[model samples]
Target chain A: MVEYKDGADFLSPDPIETQVLQGSQDSEGVELMVKKNNDRLTGWVSYTLSRSMVLINGLYEEQKVNGGVPYPSNFDRPHSFNLVANYRISRRLSFSSNIVYSTGRPVTLPVAAYYAEGRPFLLYSARNAYRIPDYFRIDLSVNLEGNLKFKKVAHSFWMLNVYNLTGRSNAYSVFYEVEDGAINGYQLSVFARPIITLSWNFKFGNYNSN
Target chain B: MNIQHTYKYTVTKLFPGGVRPKMHLWVVLIIALAVNSCIEPYFADIGDEPELISIEGSIIKGLSRQEIVISRTTSLGNPVFEPVKGCLVSVMDELNNEFVFDETYNGIYTLEIDQSSLVEGRNYKMVVVTPGGAHYESEYEILESSVPVDSVYYDIEPSLDPVNGIEADGLQFYVDLLAPDTVSRYFRWKITETYEYTSAGPIHYYYMDLSFEPVVPDDIWGLYRCWKTDELEDIFLTSTLNLATNEKKQIPLNYVSTLNDRLKIRYSLLVHQYALDEEAYNYFMQNKIATEGSGGLYTRQPQQPITNIYNVDDASERVLGYFWTSEMTSRRIFVSKLPELDVKDYFYPLEIFNMEDHGAGPFPMAIMEEDGVRITGSPICFDCTRRGGTTERPDFWE
Candidate 1:
């Protein structure tokens, strides 16, 4: 169930309404980061541990307990981590990249059934029935900038590889409805794309100001 | 002063005849930028914390009790609020009398009371304590609503000189109630239809002034029977009215008809007590599943029964109906006709029909004045493909 301060205004967020900003929950997961300072290099190795859940008490009051139920939606990931690095190629160019790996999200699997109008209502039998494969990916980007003939105009070209090493990563697992009683699960994968952008900018306003 | 110095060393090699010059531009670009650029490292991860919670719900006015709802903010569309497991809740009146409510469902608590307990002038408030010792409170006023009733009218018109010699008619009932103040309330109504047909054949047609969604007859033949033939107990529509007053302003009476005939209509209303706030209104709207739940949840309009008017007769079709006289009075007036049409003079090339796909018989019925006309003001065969045998009858009162 969703709450709004004025009425279901989807545009605004209610302070009382908490939301998932980004990334899934995981416990003690590792991440790799690398950066270049001038001719020097810097990097980091980190870890995370957490979980979250969501419920629709407004619609199905039966599932609410205590004040509400701790359904499977709350446990995204208990822990996670990242790794990064950077390298200087020349005065006009530099290379930077990061690698991330985390455990998959939890999915509810329906098992038992309750009778409704002679049809069995599929009940979510277990809290977290299945998990997708682990997630790991690398991203690399190069930055280049120079002054052109046009006054105040600077040209820049960037090449970004969202997934540098690993081709694809799966975030969550999904299962299709059985037409004749065959249990099957569908795997979801992380999006990977290589982006090339070339841009030129003219600065009329002050580049730096109070 | 910390002074930085720059230095360069060059090595020259002589060839057989002339010296060759080599420039290392790549090395110069990278070394130049490395002298000024720097990177910062910062990363921190935090876990989830229990979010805040808020409560809302309704209590029937008579005993001043309704289901109470407590919800919380979560990232998922289906956010979880605490379940009603073992929480304790009470309604406090002005005299400090506390009435305990039961946790009927997960986050719902219900209180049962009689008419005398929920006096209109009394003030009330609900207080709840969570099992973990968190406290929540909300206040409410015992607001009363008057059953509202609007004008009622009918649609009667004559079919162009061909089909049935009698006029076709339809009925429309309308009502608009206002609750300028308060949060929520429940509404219910019971309507009855009385009509007489000219033929004894199976009831082939039925029409009602339904909102957007038309409620068709379960037993097609039942369309011809009168409210008197069947038990009165079986002739009503029941629904919950937990919407805001601004939302319940208009309610329309949809009709069900079998054939071209005259009809008499009557209905009664029952209003439950409760109030709604902006929070409750938003929750209902955002989470509202159907189009019917969105805009004004009620529908009321002028109903034209007879397909035509100029070729029809003037009949008293005395249709008697009343709204909740307990709270407000309702009145209705029957009209002879709505807008009429002259189909003979309209221009058209010819109508096409597909007998197999639509299961329809002929195009002649498409010319009926009630059937909708194309942009060219000409009628298209109701079943263009006709595979399913469906016929378009704009002339038939929908």
Candidate 2:
């Protein structure tokens, strides 16, 4: 055994190591749907479960992706559910609502900062190393029909639609920025708030729809 | 019966008279604005990130002291440079001349070697032993003399600012290389800028120990003239490996919008040029891509950079940075009162509100404008060193 009062001396730097990645993608999924149809209402509820994974060693063996291991794809969402229902308070009055939920999409982001010249640069994580926040939203609409008269020149209905009832800020994508030597992250949302729209519809002899 | 939206029958009477409703112009404007996208700050959850070792060093042939820096990388949100201290560092050249570097600061090691001691065409390598006895070494890097900079010059032109999409008149600087066709084509340049500025102005009034109203003073606080020198932090890379000739003209370096104080009165640029090898050049080229940080739709995925330094025992050790040898050259130029362009000081806030706002606080020092109008801001905003700078005038300043 060798011992030193302070520390042992080591020599020679090891050679540069390279990783090899070679594989294929695999995915599996299942979906179920339940429907309710009747004179008063018609709607459906659906749920889905899925997984997507990939492995590849030879993009010219660049190791540019997930280090050759199986990782979820960019669009992977393991679980999702959607529900739609309509209720009729009267022959001419009906209200419809929709609910949806889904696991977030896979994403790659900066894990740390690389500093040079007294400034910080971004260091990214492995591809698809994380996921965005989960997504959930709800919407509703009310339909009011005018008097039913085939002899009348035309029929009309008034509709009030409220999109994104809960005003959920679902992420469309994630991005980053570097300012004053500090790095910050932000998420972009296509529809960040609820939208309400009111419209009047009329059906002529050639076309009647609301 | 719920009314169903349907197409008209071949010959049936629907809403005999179609319904027409008036739409408000404001509602259309609101809808048009709503379709635009929105953004919010986000913090990602990246499982467990590895804390890495970062070693950056360079052997400058003409400089008296060569410095090497060692530090650790931290999370992006909280990137605090953790210096690695108490290390044994030394360099050995091909001729067996070994020089030990002293710890000038926590993680910075420096060695005072005469300019003549650096011999061109000789291979130099570095070895570092951490306090804990972990050994690390950089591959043998060959030193090559650098090509001299013929001149450093500036041109006044309007730039299409990529960030703000504004075309404003600004000063664009460039450097010329007169290297013969036989030398290496890979090179890097770093520019340091020094400028003189006066405070925005002084407050004509101040509150006294016991005064019902503000009192005007015979002498006000005015940083009449102070100088600030800053090393422009962007990487300027030039490669002509593909071109048949080594000589190039008008290699663009730095650009400053006249809207800032860099060229307000008298400004100087100290340009340092370095000759690099293929590996070092490639490393910097890739790092340039990573640091530019377009963060747009076309942003290419980033990969961990390959460091020239490595662990002696394990090749898999996570090490960062490049250690290389270069014969460097530098040139300095001063400019003042150019007639072709106009200069304007960029404006900023001295108060912290929301977002990326780091301000003096809810209340800032208020100064009276030249016309007696009042403006509130931090001391920096009113002094030559406002924003970030040194108050002492540089001896090199004319």
Candidate whose lDDT is highest = 2
**C-alpha lDDT values of all predictions:** 0.37, 0.74
Candidate 1 versus truth, CA RMSD in Å, comes to 21.9
Kindly list the per-residue Cα lDDT of model 1 for residues B1-398, writing each as its tens digit.
22221111231232223333234434444345333222222111113422434344444453344566544323221222334356787777778878788888876678776656665546676666778775555544443443443334333333332345544333434444454444234333333333222112222222222221223345434322222211122111222354433445335444422133233222222222223333333223322221222232111110111100010121222111100101212333332222342122112233332234222422122221224421111222222222221222222122
Candidates in order: C-alpha RMSD to true structure: 21.9, 13.3
| Angstrom error at residue B203, model 1 | 25
Looking at model 1, give its docking quality level. Answer: incorrect
Candidate 1 residue lDDT tens string, A1-210: 332111222332444343211222223333444434444455666676555554434343222321233434434665577877776676456677787877767644333222211112223322443454567777776655343334443344444444434445344444433334332334443243232333444344222211
lDDT of 2 by residue, B255-297 (tens): 8787666787888899999888888887777667666645432
**What TM-score would you give candidate 1 relative to the actual structure?**
0.31
How close to the true structure is residue A125 of candidate 1, measured as C-alpha lDDT? 25
DockQ per candidate, 2 decimals: 0.03, 0.20
Which regions of candidate 1 deviate over 4 angstroms? A1-210, B1-54, B63-65, B69-82, B104-107, B140-174, B178-398
For candidate 2, the per-residue lDDT at B325 reads: 91
